[model samples]
Target: MPKKIAAGNWKMNGTRASLPDAMAIAATPAGDCAVVLCPPATLLSQMGTEGLALGGQYCHPNASGTHTGDISAPMLADAGATYCITGHSERRADHGESDADVCAQTEAAWSAGLVAILCIGETLAQREAGETLAVLTAQLNGSLPNGATAENTVIAYEPVWAIGTGKVASPDQVAEVHDALRAQVGPEMSLLYGGSVKAGNAAELFALENVNGGLVGGASLKAADFAPIITALAAS
Candidate 1:
């Protein structure tokens, strides 16, 4: 079975005070999905090793220092991070990361042996214009590294409109896109859905064909909300 995924993107949230949740989730029995947590770079090592695997919020394209604010992929790996999110919507919108930038970051990720959670999504205007798939295709085509593989690539489709917007794509709509992406990347690739993946709709979403797992945001902050979503992902 393709390991079901339950990944958390901590974004700008979490502090040294937030260590407890990682501990709890690590202890929870994961059924089928390979669970992961991407906290701020400050917490990766402190988050521990036994059960929880670590991830990084973002990583620089180069492997060396002097970039100042940027964290390199090798640094992430050194911190014990197993995965790292690149090209997140926030990075695209806030920093204006071009497709080439995302591709560079993707390559750097593999160089450091960290799986890249490559995020690509369309805004509401694009979705309304019936450009959803085309936008995704273009982003995938431009951002994916030439040496992509299932072991190191995980695509996250986080509708820019729904992220932190309390809105989620219906199961059917999400499935339509995920299935399309599967054909694009081949069966071995894992297509993950993000954007307000709360406990309430997780099981409904998980039931859909090709709906492997989630890249949770706000809901992942609290074990109360994140736990139920993890429970829902257990293979039926």
Candidate 2:
């Protein structure tokens, strides 16, 4: 299996001043685990210098084009990003991004020599209807490209209701989805759990059999809140 990865998604937050938080995280030792910080586009190049793997929040499927304010995968790579997140629920909900669009973006990330962190999950209504596994299966099949592998891709399962809502999926609930994902994608692919991941719950989450690491949100904004989670993964 690939080494565990603890990735932080700053998501429309951070400025030059906030680079210090990432710098602090980079300064911490992450034994046997890889750490990545995906800040907004403005900080990719600067954050790259902090010695942590750097990533982008999103990338346009096309390599380049006239799409105003859109950054392509190649452009992200050029700007010092080693990874790019796609198919996040926020994008799906806000921009109406479809599964096919995520697949194209994943391909674009691979084409640019960047790892694609593909996000998938079910909404509260879908989960309430006991359709979590079914929803995950469909999203996994539709979003992942044919040539995906451990080296080029990572999967993040972020239950829509839990994200930023202080509601986290129980260990058993997380295990079921992650196990199914492992079965579908094979054991080699790295699978991450996101949504309300914090220091208090990090170790328990990382202890699950199939969970490799995390795709952190609000907690990742500060080194103080994020480092303990990385510490937990390292211990796991």
Candidate 3:
């Protein structure tokens, strides 16, 4: 079976004042699940809590370079991060990152001994046109680098329209995508559902076949909001 994980992407949020929430989350018992917190780069080093894993929101494809202000996978590892997110929709859309770029970043994460949480998803328009599976499959094939394994990589499907929008894919939608991903990646690879996941709907989502965990957003900012989701995943 794949490892059950409850990962929180704090995004471009958090500060010294927000450290307490991370601490509180780390204090929560995760049962059989592993809890990871990917805070903003500013807090990744400081968020080395004992029970929770630390990760970087993004990383440069280069190990070390003249790319000013860009953090590399090696740099994240040096700062105590054991995992790094690559190909997040926001990065793909906002920064115009191509699938080739994401594949390079995934390889960089592997070189630095960090697990790459590769994200893939479709926009609402794509979903509306019934092209969700094709889109996801293309992104997965394009963004995932060669030599990826269950141990070194995780797949997160967060629909572009649902992220931070209080919209979530239905259980049927999640099952279809996750099932397809599982077929392609094999049974051992962990698959996570993201986008508007909260305590209210976590259990149902986690209960679905092929859903190993979740990649949370806003709810992750506070332990009070995120802990319940972890507990739900543990139960699943």
What RMSD, rounded to one decimal, does every model reach? 1.0, 0.8, 0.5
State TM-scores per candidate: 0.97, 0.98, 0.99
Most lDDT-accurate candidate? 3
Pick the winner on lDDT between candidates 2 and 3: 3
- Each candidate: what lDDT? 0.88, 0.93, 0.96
For model 1, the superposed segments whose C-alpha errors exceed 4 Å read none
Better of 2 and 3 by TM-score: 3
Candidate 1: tens digits of C-alpha lDDT, residues 1-236: 45578999888889988888888887767776778899889988898757677889888999996887899999999989989999998999899999999999999999999999999999999999999999999999999988898899999999999899999987777987898898999888777899899888988888877877889998887777788888898753
- Tens digits of lDDT, candidate 3, 120-220: 99999999999999999999999999899999999999999999999999999999999999999998999999999999999999999899999999999
lDDT of 2 by residue, 1-236 (tens): 75699999999899999988998999877898889999999988888654489998888999988999999999899999999999999999999999999999999999999999999999999999999999999998899999999999999999999999999999999999999999988888899999999999999999998999999999999999999999999999
Q: Model 2 off-target regions past 4 Å?
A: none
Q: Candidate 3: what lDDT? A: 0.96
